[model samples]
Target: MDGPFATAFSLIASGDPALMQIIGLSLRVTLTAVLIACAVGLPLGAALALARFPGRGAVIVVFNALMGLPPVVAGLIVYLMLSRSGPLGSLALLFTPTAMIIAQTLLILPIVISLTRSVVEDLWAEYREQLLSLGAGRLRAVPTLLWDGRVSLLTGVLAGFGRASAEVGAVLIVGGNIAGHTRTMTTAITLETARGQLGLAVALGIILLTLTLTLNAVAWGAGQWARGRLG
Candidate 1:
């Protein structure tokens, strides 16, 4: 443990190019996927909060269930779709960062959508009558509720980011974990472990743990801020 921790600290202190590259690609893929998920999920979730259509309960159930979708299943789905004989194969996105991004997006999208829906729905439940009295239809009230719920919604976003950053199976499948191309922190750690590079793997694990801790701290701070505002 001491030796591995020493190596981990040394790698961090030295800024090894390979380590930095893995970190950069991990951030790039995860951030892009989070952005895409939030962009699509936020408004859609707000709409789900406001909509009163039939079978809405079913839709909600499906999304809530999807929040638990396995990483490997998500990877396999992307792999199949991106394979040469698959419908989207023509785009040649398989075994690339873009493919990894897509896979992560799928994994995290349900989480974003489900949590956003819960936040906005609670806000709507409290404000619906007032919003209606103001001549604002349900559709027109979405943005207002979404804005008001922004702090709470941030927890969902950060959760999605954490999920994306930690996931190895999905990205590995779609990105091929190729050196200097698709390799990311999590996948690199997996490879390093397999090759008995325990020190490097432990180093990468330390970095990933730090990142997750930071994200959770941010989420906790946001929750506190929201509570203070409400108080």
Candidate 2:
């Protein structure tokens, strides 16, 4: 353990290009997945919350349940669906970054929807009466409510990104952890650890933790700044 720890520290201090590439690739995939999640999930969540159609409650319930789904299950589903003999086999997306991104989007979409729904619900409760009293129609109030809940929406997005970036099981299965190709920090850590190369694994693990912490810190600071400006 001590030897692995020492080697891990040395690897970080050495500025290894391979390690940097892994980190960069992980960041790229996670950022892309999160952005895609927001683009699709935000409006859907807001609409689900503000709309008064039948079965809205059922949809919210399903989304909330999906928010707690196991990542390994999601990985298995994507792997099966994108495998060579599967329906999407012709696209040849398996073991690729795009596949990993797709799996991650599936994993985090529920979180985005559920969290954003909660945010919208709160805003609706607070402002619905006032907006309606002022002769504002439903369409006018929807955007206003969303704007007021911007901080919560941002927090939800940060939460989704955090979830996507930290996930290992799904990316590992769907991406195949191919070295110098589909390899990401999480996948690298898992492969190295399995191969008993504790030093490399621990090094990669440290890198992942550092990236996650840095991202969360930035999100927190940004959310605080946004709230202050709004106030």
C-alpha local distance difference test of each model: 0.91, 0.85
| Deviating ranges (above 4 Å) for candidate 2 | 1-9, 132-136
Off by over 4 Å in 1: 226-231
Candidate 1 lDDT score at position 207: 85
| Weakest lDDT window of 10 consecutive positions for candidate 1 | 1-10
Candidate 2, lDDT over the whole model: 0.85
Q: Report the error of model 2 at residue 168, Å.
A: 1.3
Measure candidate 2: CA RMSD: 2.1
Q: Write the per-residue lDDT of candidate 2 for residues 21-113, one digit (tens) a residue.
A: 888889888889888988888878877878888888899999999988888888899999999998999999999999999999998899898
TM-scores of the candidates in the order shown: 0.94, 0.91
